[model samples]
Each structure stands twice: as C-alpha cells, then as structure tokens.
Target: MDMFRRTFAEVNLDHVAHNFEVLKAAFPNTSFLCPMVKANAYGHGDVAIALCLQQAGARHLGVCLIEEALLLRRGGVTANILVFRGFDREGAEQLLANNLTPVVSTWDQLEALEEMAKTPVKIHLKFNTGMNRLGFSIEEAEKLFDKCWRHPKIQVEGVLTHLFNGEDADELDGDSADQLGKLLRILLVFKPLNPLNHSLNSAGILNALIVREQKNPQHILNQVQWGLRPGLMVYGFNPLKRQDILPLKPVMTLKSVASTYRMLKVGEVVSYGGTWKAKRDSVVAIVPIGYADGYHRILSNKAEVLFNGYKVPVVGTICMDFLMVDVTDAIHGCDLNDLRDKEIILFGKSDQGQFISAEELAHRAQTITWEILTSVGERVPRVYVGDWAKRLGVAN
Candidate 1:
C-alpha cells in the first residue's frame, strides 16, 4: 500500500446520483439528457463516470472528440453517444461504424460524412449561435440541412446551437435571443426540416428565467423542439450565478491522503522557490500531489488542504510530486495523532467531516468550475461509491 502512494481521489457516486436527480427534477420535460463526459468525464475517469451516469438514467452521453466516443463504445456503453465536436474525414467512418453521432459544424464535414458506407448515420447540425467557436452560419446551415435531408444515408437527429453569453448574469440582453431567432429562421428556410431542434446548455436553461423576464421569451426558448443539453448541472456544478435560488449539488468530490509529515524550524523555507518561510516551529505535511498531478501550480502558497478535520495552510512552492502545508496548529493533539499517512483532503472533504467545495477551489484558482473538474490528473485513482456505483458494478 505504501508503494502505491497513500494519496488517491475518492469520487462519491452518491453525490453524482444526487446531482442527476436534481437535473432531472429541474428539466422534467427534457427529451434527451446528454451529460458531457469528455476529458475522462472531467477527470473522474470516463468509463466510471459514464457508467454511473448511465445507471442514473442518462439516455445520451456527450464527448468532445471521436476517440472519446470510441473509448466509450469499447467500454460497453451502448447509450446514444453524441460527439459534441464534429470530426474530419479521417474519423468520420469510425464515427459512423461505432454508431456515434457527430455534431456537423461545416458543409465539408457533412460532405465527408456523406461519402461513408451507406449506413443511416444520426447527426446533429451545430448552428453558430453567437459562440463563433463551431457550427455553421445561417446560409451554410440551410444548405447543409437541405443536402442531408435529401441524402438517403444521413439521418439528421438534431439541430443544436450554443449560447455565448449564458454565464453572464448582469446585462439581460437579447444576444442569445437573436441567436436562437436566427436558428429558427434557418430552420424555417429549410422547411419541414425538424430534427430535435435544441439551443440551450446548462447556463442557457439556468438562465431561462432571465430570458423569460426579458423583452423576448418566445424567440429564445419557445423554438426548442427536443429539449436541453445540460453538461455541468448534471455533474453537480451550478452553471448560473443565481445558484442559491435553485437547488444544485456538486457530483464529484476530489479527495486524497497525506503520505508524509515533518517539522520545520522558524526560519526554514519550503519547496523549490523557498518562498514560504516558517513563522514558528511548524509541523509541515507533504501530500504526494503537485502540478504534474493536475494540482495547479498557481495554488502553491495560496491554497489550503483539510487535514485531521482542520483547514491547514499550504506553505512553499508546489513541486512535481509533493506539496507542503503548515500544520503547527493542526499538530496539537487529536489532529497530530497518526499524522504520518493521515488522509489529506485536497479539494473535496476530510474523514473528520470537513469539506472543501469545488466552487471554492475554483474561486481560489481564478478559473471556472469546468476547468477544476477537467483538470484533475489521471494518476489519482477514482473510487465510485453509492447506489449508482453499485448499479454500475463499481465497488464502494
């Protein structure tokens, strides 16, 4: 056990189930609940998280790349997997053969996909609704829809668009409204072309209240035919800033253990930069996790980890395989007992009942909740626990 490094992340599947239930309750009318599981299911391990989500009644799974879809197919995930990012000609056949849906963003991709062996492939045409990242323009989208509608080998399952300013709570503007309006206009141009028309993400749905109260409601949400595509909310992170108003829970809790402990004199510095100096005879604990392990280097001396039920301040520069925490106050009595190999709560919770929320960690890191979840390194072992875990055949 010592050879394996006492540190590993424990993922709570119960929280994941809770998060799924919350999303289900919020959007009871959703036709397809596609939870994004790309980037190793946001570092929770793709197979494990996808299995857990599938058990929790997730009908569809979303991944960023074709390889991710292939990985899931190989892992026995039979659910309808949608490749959010459309692929090129090289990967289109594999996408079709594996029964994976690609969100076609351009006419060239659609043309490439058309040349594949004549198997009716389900595809979602991504409309460039303000994000300007992917998807087709109004004219291009119309032409592609017409072409695919006429083609015998292609089955257009959905027409989707992403919101650009969904996260912003302030300015209740109509940019999103206009984008949705444009999508509808494109849909109408290609008359009788109705394939699961959807245009909202977690932020879009969460921010629907704003759209309802704004100048135009019909233009933004009323056009959605299929339902919503919620990624973050399904994983238990609130997409809107007004999360206090709506009940949402975080699904993943990243937990690791403390591997070693030491005592440092008053003037001694810690780690690579020697930036952190001990103010007093402090007890320092080293966690076998660092930047190389996905713990951001920005959190060097600014972060805190829960140890022995207490929040201990992290000291010194974060190295590749370890980080130091000032534990003088934490070493008094009960907190100090069995200090060596004691579990360290990195970004989740402690055994003694202390917890660090992902939102808090994201704030400290000056990034988004998505980044925090996706940044979790591969080395950390994921242990799924709860009803969903049991249903997925993962041990507690």
Candidate 2:
C-alpha cells in the first residue's frame, strides 16, 4: 500500500553501499564486514537494508535473534547470518535448517547446541574480555576449548568479543587496548582451531585502522585475520564522529510535511501542558508525527527541524500523534499554499541544502545516535530509494 501519511523515512540504498565501500577501504585487512541488522536495522527496515548490503557484496550479516535471521532468510537474503543472541533447542534446529550461525555466549547455550546438532554446526564463540554483559569470561578459555571447541557437532568458525571502549584504542593502556590484549590471548589458545577472529564494532574498526597504519609488527592486534562487525557506521553515523577517517552518508532521512498551520497570539500556549507560550504572534506548523511515531517526547520544545530551508523551533509538548513547529520566520514571504508541497526535515539533508543530523537530534534529546536511529517508530513507512532500490524494484 502507498503511504497514507505525508510523514515517512527515505532510505537511500546507494548511501548504504557507499558507506560499505568506505568501510572496506578503511579497513583493507578485514576478512569480512558483518553488518548488524538488529532492531529492524536500527529502524531503517532490516529486510531491505540486508538485501542492499547483500547486493553490495556483504558475505556476512548480524542480527540479534534467530527470528530476525529467519526474517532475512524468508526475505530472500542469502548471506551468512550470525545470530547474536544464543538460541534454545528449537532455535538451534532452525538455525541449522536455515544455514545460520549462532554466537555461543553461555554454557547453557553450548548445551543447547549440543542437544540440537545432528550435523556439524558452525558457531562463533563469544568471550567476555571486559564488557561483563555476555560471553564466557577469559578465565573460562581453557574450559571452553576443552569442553565445547572439541565437541564433534560444534565447529568453531570464529572467535569474538565486544570491546567495551573502542574509542580508547589510541591509548595503549586504555580499556580497549586491555580488552584487545585479552582477546589476542584467547586467540592464541584458539589459533590451532582455525577460527575467524573479531572484536571490533564500528568504533573498534576505526581503531583497528589506526593501529594498522602504525605498522607496528609487534602490536597485539596483528595476531590474526580481523573480521569486523560494524553496526552504526554501515548505516552512516560515526560512533567517534570521525568522518575524516571515512566519510559516511546517512542512509535514512526522516521527513514530513506541515499538515496545517495555526496562528497563536501573544501569551497563547500550545500542546498538552501549555509548555510553550508564544511571546508574540506566531505561525505554527502542525506536523503529522509525534512520540508514538518514534519522535521522542523529550524533544518537545527542545528540538529544531528544517522548514522551508530554515531552522524552526519545535514548540509545546510533543503529542502521541502530532508535533508543533514555530515557522513564523520560515513562512515570512511564502503563502501557506507555497509550503503545502515542501517537506520539514526532522533529520538528514534537505533539498534546499539545510541539514539536521540524527546526532544533532540525539544531542537535543540528551541521548545517543544509536537510540535516535533505532527509536524511529515502526509506523513511519520507510520509503526506499537509490540504485539498489531501483534494481530491487522498491524505489520510491
């Protein structure tokens, strides 16, 4: 069905490909680039993005659950999907049936694999260096090798870990470095098993590049083939904000049009709590999107959006299905009819050359870019665009 509302998100598949190319070029030593598509590809629509990346030559993809992996398999994605969340017996069976790989983090997960495997199954072993969230701790290395790695049904295809602070790779004694040191030590124990080694996410990938450029043969990171699982960077937001390293074009642009306008007199308040009272005559554009649509309520009267090539302040409490923008200056010379066809950009570049990034919105909301991107509401239709979209017959 076509979009029923003027509000939607435009996803550029070309930008996705460009970002992939940039990442590949930045990390030439990377054996594979596993694009994380969890949380609906951070709300950009997973199936479409996965298909785009697969067409772009991605051999591997990452998702948080077997259900997500199954979604991709059903969507015609043929890449090697690594399910981050460990599975139960039924999930393990499904993984085998779909040719999906599972990351074994806990012993119970290993037991599930052992219980479900009738044939040899490839798996990535997750070791906890410092994150303390998931994975087998480093102290459990010898026990894992002895108990699971040698299990006949379980084939150790890769060894992996999460770097708690990849942004600190510059400091030799920093948390990231210390974590890498531990990972490399684990690699030493698993080297004979011949598993792919990976620990870096987007920030870690950039750090890997930094360490690579140094060309120090003695660096702890040079121990094995580096497989990177880049999450945010692939979708075009930099974790460390280092665009100079690899310039990334944002894939998703959230946009909407003013549904109608309201003229407010001085001292007249707006929205749920009368939080924003106009100090003078104001022209407010009522946008057809709100907190329910993934626009955060904290952004009420705190964020700005691009309207008619100008920055307009968001006014009043953001409602469940609407938001109000003060566009007095933006509509100075244009008739209301003139803006009927214009778009108001919540984030990403506007055709008129003005831009508002997700990072900017995240700052306004006192959150991170990841939360901002993933929080985009499921109800907001994702309008796919660009070369891949055209080829895939999903272009808008």
lDDT: worst 10-residue window of model 2: 217-226
Lowest lDDT 10-mer window, candidate 1? 217-226
- Residue pair clashes in candidate 2: none
Per-residue C-alpha lDDT of model 2 across residues 1-396, encoded as one tens digit per residue: 478789999999999999998888776767767989988998899999999899988899999988899999999999999999887778878988899999999888888888877898888999999998989999888888887556889888889998888887656578987888888889888877978988888887876677677877666555555679999988898777555677889998999999898889999999998999999999899999999988999999999999887999999999999999999988977888877747889999999878899988999899989999999898899999898899987787
lDDT of each: 0.75, 0.87
Model 1 lDDT tens row, 262-364: 7789898888969998888878887888887778888878888887778988788989888888877876765545666777777775666677877777788
**TM-score leader:** 2
Relative to the true structure, candidate 1 has a C-alpha RMSD (angstroms) of 2.5
* Candidate 2 error regions (>4 Å): 148-150, 214-219, 222-225
Q: Could you list the CA RMSD of all candidates, in the order they appear?
A: 2.5, 1.5
